[model samples]
Target: MKKIVLAIDSFKGSLTSQEAEQAAAEGILQVYPACEILQIPIADGGEGLLDTLLPYLQGHSISLYAHNPLMELIETCYGIASDGQTAIIEMATISGLPLIPPSKRNPFEATSFGTGELIKDALDKGCRNFIIGLGGSATNDAGLGMLQALGYRFFNKQGEELGLGGKIMKEVASIDTKSIHPALEEAFFTIVCDVINPFCGPKGAAYVYAPQKGADEAMVKELDAGMASLASVIRKTTDRDIAVCPGAGAAGGMAGAFLAFTNCLLKSGIHLVLEMLSFSRRIKNADLIITGEGRIDRQSAMGKVPYGVLTKAQEQDIPVIAIAGSIEEVNYLNQAGFQAVFSITPAPLSLQEAMEPIVARQNIRGLVSQICRVIEINPRVISSSPSHSKFSSFKKR
Candidate 1:
């Protein structure tokens, strides 16, 4: 092949997007040593988003001390670009579920204060444009803790300031935005959200996600009630109703808080990342495009990295192939536009063994190398055949 583009997502617990791309490149080079390969690490506004977008945005990391979900101090970092006018904050870096052990996971006591602290620092540094990724959060506070860190105050009926944690939402009877950060008025936020859960309700943040963050049936109901109460207070105070907004529940209603309190817009994670990266323009002349994530299932066709990359490649009639750690619904994925779908695993193995970084890298490299050999033997098999025909033949194997 003349030119190939590797636009792959992180393999979750194992390889990062860059590492996965590097492995794929190594495989391609084994067959075509002189081929031009372009690697673009990608994430759909989740854990690895900052690292994926920083270089393209001409940004640098800013490390600082921030509070974890349990209110403990932890060293964390965010990204700043365009001479500090723009900031990229991934919620997972600060208040993510992984930071808290399973034994310690408690949405009621967890807080998003650290995420707010990052934003506050960026604002102080003259950042008025914020790209915040709302994913993998450990709290269900409706962003009360975050707003507090940003200088907004919440008070109980006794006129007492409420402290941090999701439980505080139930006690919040009044909101005081008068002392909010002055720079907030000039700020614009772009929230990257993949889920469409509303701020409060049966399908909302607390009910659907709090359980995973250590809430039992009783705690879930309580957290949901608190979220509802906070939503009411937010509506009354800001004249903005975020209770039913799609994606408002993401990151434990953090998106709702930004909608209620700031000039912000919510966007689909993958689409926003693709647009920011100028994905279509970058792959305009690519002979082939390879994209994948940790797994490919029915959801993979729904705004995930591989689907997003496939759509962009389709616009230019470029054939796209996908390689994942595991795969399901192969027929559906083929219908979704991939010229071929492959699982990098060479043998039956347990999940833990499959996820080892070295093993994953080697498997991906070997898989891609074999794929390249097939292409080298008969270039027309991929370049000239219809997408469906190519996928159909591969499925038989």
Candidate 2:
């Protein structure tokens, strides 16, 4: 491995993207002392986006008082680029399920109103270009609460404004969009999403994601029905049929509402992020690319971090290897494009022990060192150049 690239996602509770990439780089250097190694810290358009983007953006953060999932006040922040026109907002910061205690988790009771406040706050900061990261949600109200905060009114059969909740959506008769914030007309939104589930049905938002937010079987059915009914209303009022739109279910139908209400586009999470970070230019001539996430499973093939990185690496015919905290149901990963897969756990330790920062780093470094040794002894990765040190050169920026 002469010219190598390391682009790994944060290992969740263990290592951040930078830390994991550093660990892998250290191990690779242990074998190939003079090899050129490039590290690309990466995220799947969700939790780590703000951290990874700060360097590229040279930006400052703006803290705003916003409401949580249960409509309680809290202080959260968004990123503002040095140019001050671009703002990056993560929806999970305010409305994510993790913020609420287990005893208080309830999708119907939760609201996305706080998420809208973040966007509005960014607008007030004179940001016209917005990147919205949609993940880790706690609500199943079809983003009705968010729309409400944006000044879109939901009226019932008697023309009285309805309260927020998935169950109350069944009583919605019409929407009044004449009062939406003026800044939205001039703003552009790029939404980052991974799931392709639609607005309603067995594969839709409520049935596919609501149960995780404290919804029981009956509540899931109720929320699903509400989503179906709201889709019809959106079609009648906005002329946009989001009922079967891909990625419409993301963040509890937040994507669908953004599609209908804002001038925006939805993109696959990891691909969008990598494009923004100029990943292809950094790894154009790499001999081997190493990428991974917290877990590798059938779901990892669904446009997650490693799958997205592997897809980009394949364009240059670079062999790609993936490391994970654990591997499960990954029979098709290699077929999809990965050259190899390895788990970071060195022994039969429980998940909690494996996630220890020190232990995770040691395991990652040991595995990567061994893999480099194997590649070094193999003739396939050797370059045509006389010296292994002078194999390939790729731009860093």
Candidate 3:
């Protein structure tokens, strides 16, 4: 390998992208010490948004005192691009499922209020270009809780302010936006989203994701109804039916709420991240591209970072390989245009044992070394075939 690019996504719950890149680099260097290696830590927008963009945009992290899903105060941070006008906010930072302990998770009680607070803080910092990542939330409030934090009020028929959470959407008789933040009028928001479900339906936010946030059957139905009602009110306010919009179901319907309440656009999370970093240009001349996540499965083929990277490599006619913790259910990857996929778990270790960063790194290193050793032993192979014909040729016409 003359020039290899590492654009691996974070191995969630185990390795950061940077760490994975380093491990892969070590293994590659073990086999080809003179080869050039480039590391580009990446994310799919849900996780590692700030980490991935911090270097690309020359941004700085700004910490703020904020509230978590349950409304308790916590310290969180967002990113501001070097230009100082663009802010990157990951909704999971404040309203994420991981914020609350698994035992205390309650989608009905969780709120997106802190997400609004994070945006308001960025607005206060004079940021108007907002890239909001929408996923991993522990709320089903249709983002009304977030709106409340941004100074939009929700009043019941009796003029009483309703409590927080998806269940409380039942009492929302009307919305008051007169007190909304003025900055929102001028701000441009690009929501980083991946879900295609509408705001409310059988396949929507509540039914599809709420169970992971601790909701039961009844709560899902209630939250879905509430989301539908919220969408109706948003239509009245903005003349757009965001409830049925693609990705509106993401982040407890925050995608639709942002569109309805502010100047915002929706985009696929991985694509947006790639564009922001000008990944196409970077991958143009790469001899090889390495990328993967914690697992590679059917879902990985659907706009995940690995697939996103694969698309770019295929566009550039660069051979690509993936190093994943688990390679189950990814048999379609060869047809999807990947050269090869290797599991980081070297042996038949248990999930918990294999997922340890050290273990994963060792496995990744060993596998990469072995792959490189094979390449070194057969120089004619690279000249004749790419991944033994699994990948398209990178030869220039």
Candidate 4:
């Protein structure tokens, strides 16, 4: 039986990585039941990483009490690996865009403090190696609130402790590390981030990303000013100009805050996921590999999951096929080593309609079925076919 490795990202808002893999697996089985199938759910270190890592770590989910940007208590979830030696903290669970109400959306008011609380909880659970995701955040507070929760203290001019939130950062007069958790100093943190935006100014988190979180023109200006103020304080205290630091703008400047406050290392999220999944070792023996994301475009070639997977597959001289929600600038993926690319949508459907759980499953199943049919007729097409050569031939014709 031929060994096939099926790796795919969660179809955002449609299906989880496990469900997507099952749907594709069902399709492949229909065509070749005798073949061996392996499922590897993927994430680019953003929204779906928790699901992706759960299978590897033998982890389980737990609900924790957390405060939103407004300090309103809410129920949130994080994961602890089976070994109890690691933890997975998805920032979106505590400070995502969806948690805030539309009218109340305010980047300056949002805080990563709840995220800090989640981390503290994990640390208390005996988790010392942290894999923190740095995407889908709704704050620009520079992680001061998170630091505060970890025993660092943020104070105003009067030496009064500031409440947890971005708005409070503007009044900060000092930061005290004397109370920082002892466990934190011994811990190793890996921040999975693909963004490299600076902390302040036009290109910084607040100025560049506040509008998307419901900040208006005026709010953007105010948040930017607040971020600038926070940066000055950080520069004065840490002797590190975190405001100009690359990736400081990620997750609304949470990246900058984590770096300044902790001994965390920033890394390409997709690359880190690939390493944790051990995709390199698997690619060595696979006959053909498949990978995809919610969308495959020119950007997917730039260190995204599909690009990471395909790059490694290329090293093994294996071929790759991509299946995505929609195809945009698909020709771009060819250069990334994809032998073929397929879009999940069968007919014209609105984005919302396509995203319906059942509809997405059906679409992906059908797409995989179509691919299986072609593969049955010419299994070597993906295994040995010259992708760019075919394009060149077509151009010549």
Ranking by lDDT: 1, 2, 3, 4
lDDT of 2 by residue, 1-397 (tens): 4588999999986788999999999999998888899988988877777777867989998888999988899999889999999998888888887889888888878899998888888888799999888888888888888888878899998999888766677788899988988888999999988899998899999999998899999999988888899899889988999999999999999999988888999998899889878998999778788999889998998989999998887676777889999998656987786778899887899999999999999999999998888776664443333332333442222
lDDT, candidates in the order shown = 0.90, 0.85, 0.84, 0.81
Say what the RMSD of model 4 is.
Answer: 4.0
List where candidate 2 sits over 4 angstroms from the true fold.
Answer: 379-397
Tens-place lDDT per residue, model 4, 195-251, is: 778888888887788888878888777777877888898889888788788888888
Best by lDDT: 1
Alpha-carbon runs more than 4 Å astray in model 4: 101-103, 158-160, 380-397
Local error of candidate 3 at residue 396 (angstroms): 21
The best-first sequence of candidates by TM-score reads 3, 1, 2, 4
Question: Which whole-number lDDT from 0 to 100 does residue 119 have in model 4?
Answer: 89
RMSD, model 2, all Cα superposed? 3.9
Count of clashes in candidate 1: 0
- With a 3 Å backbone cut-off (N, CA, C), the pairs that clash in candidate 1 are none
State residue 311's C-alpha deviation in candidate 3, in Å: 0.9
